[model samples]
Target: MSSPTSIAPAARLSDVHVAFDGVDVVCGVDLHVAPGELAAIAGPNGAGKSTLLEVLAGTRSPRRGQRAVPGAVAFVPQRAAIPPRLPVTVRDVVAVGAWGRLGPWRRADASAHAAVARSLSRMEITELASSPYASLSGGQQQRTLLAQGLARQADLLLLDEPTTGLDADSSRRIRSVLREEADRGVAVVCVSHDAPLLEAADRVVRLEAGRVVGAPRT
Candidate 1:
């Protein structure tokens, strides 16, 4: 196995800092995730884990620092971030990941549909494709979101609390899927407190008061 430092970075944050209303959330933290690596961010609730993730996702610009990420990035936010009672099916939600490649006016082509189908199968949610996304359990919703991220075929995959509050089996499945994604050369980064996920990570970055305190390996 290649060391994380040996591989070129798929995403990088240099002296990154984020603030909301003049209060800093992420403070001068540098991080880089290599392709085919699973990196987990762990910290207390207000430690700026999610804020740092948003910086890497390029959804939130840092007040002072640099971010380098690929154009093809897939971000799976916490379930609560998704609007409740959306009038869409599981397949429909997953299919939307392809929209970046197909512009606003273009319809999904054959290959795009194939990617959605493959993602659904990979996440073991093909059976739930026709199910209403809002009606599914928390675990099911998480799986659906993972499938959507997979469908994007992105270079960087960022997730927030993927296995939080999940049952044993669901958590195990999600962790395994994350490893599989890394093995397929996708840089996988997740903000999580899940022990199993952290234990399985190639690198675990711990943040305290918006700073990286340690980067320990299992």
Candidate 2:
């Protein structure tokens, strides 16, 4: 983890717009996330937080505006689609983060294995590294997904309602990890309704009807 020092911006969106089925989801939203900063997005249900995150992740193309995402962007969706009967272990799931950088026909190498171990340790899930991924509790599963994201060495992390299904303790643990990441020069953007979790952010942006309703402030 890098020290909490001044760093460059990891992502910037200028007049970004996104529409789904001819319905605007994000309208002319301008946002910037600097390295080592944690920015929280809060809004009512159907405020388009998830849609904006998907656009930022490059998974959903924007309808307009210039968007720049530096380095790798890791996104943990609200509900990760994990196979209920897959024969994968926790460590194996984390190693999937390296798939994008792997060569064709290549398997997990020593470096990838080491990264998986380190990510699990950082998420405090080393003890569950060998557990069947589907057998873990919801909170544990969320932690494993977070480890997968961390293993990718992502410069920008976009979490969509990560604490939705988590208990108080689990939510706190996850928020602590996110804060630690922000301190390490990783831009963190979390879309959540959790009031307590918002305190970890340096700024908060409120969205409504696919547009920013007010100036983002601390």
Candidate 3:
């Protein structure tokens, strides 16, 4: 495992601050995800969990502080935003994760094919490879979306409510895959209110009223 000081952070928020219309949503938080670490951000609805995620993903600039994240950051939004009704199959959707490197052509080499297959299998969605994306159930769609993010094998992975609507078995599979990704040196920061996920994480950061209160005792 790489130490926080030794390995450059996949994403780092230094004294970050965020607000909306004169109201403070997040304030003065310093967070960093080192290589090979799985960190969980847990907070209530108004605690700015998703806001921080957007900051790290570069979708939103902090009101104050610096945002440093890898160029290959993969941000998987909640399930409702993930399921695509396009005519593409699950395989096609997952394969798109590699498009950043493989280009838009379908005639990718064997290595690219293997990568897509591996990602699907990791999320236990390999059997749905041929199923149309819109045809899968909600849980199945979530799994497929996860496969797409995992396929990126990005330096940083940010997910919001990743396990929402998943069954116990499905959630376990997803968590296991994320742990494995961290083992392989991907910095993973997941925003979730689920207790099981927080317990399983390598570290948990709790927030209240948009400010980090303290680390959870668990």
What lDDT score belongs to each candidate, Candidate 1 first?
0.89, 0.84, 0.83
Which residue pairs clash in candidate 1?
none
lDDT of 3 by residue, 90-128 (tens): 998888777655556557778778889998888888899
Which lDDT value does model 1 have at 76? 92
Report the candidate with higher lDDT, 2 versus 3: 2
Compared with the true structure, model 1 gives a TM-score of 0.95
Decoy 2 TM-score against native: 0.91
Each candidate: how many clashes?
Answer: 0, 0, 0
* Most accurate candidate by TM-score: 1
Please give the lDDT score for candidate 1: 0.89
How well does candidate 2 score on lDDT at residue 44?
Answer: 91
Which regions in candidate 3 have their CA more than 4 angstroms from the true location? Answer: 80-85, 102-107, 216-218
Measured on C-alpha atoms, candidate 3 has an lDDT of 0.83
Candidate 2 lDDT over 1-218, as tens digits, reads 33223455688889998988888889999987788888888899998888888888999888899889968888887766877888899988888886644646788788877888888998889999999999999898888888888887789999988898787777888999899998888899989998878876888888998899864555
Query: CA shift at 82, candidate 2, in angstroms?
Result: 1.9
lDDT of 1 by residue, 140-176 (tens): 8989988888888899999999999887877888899
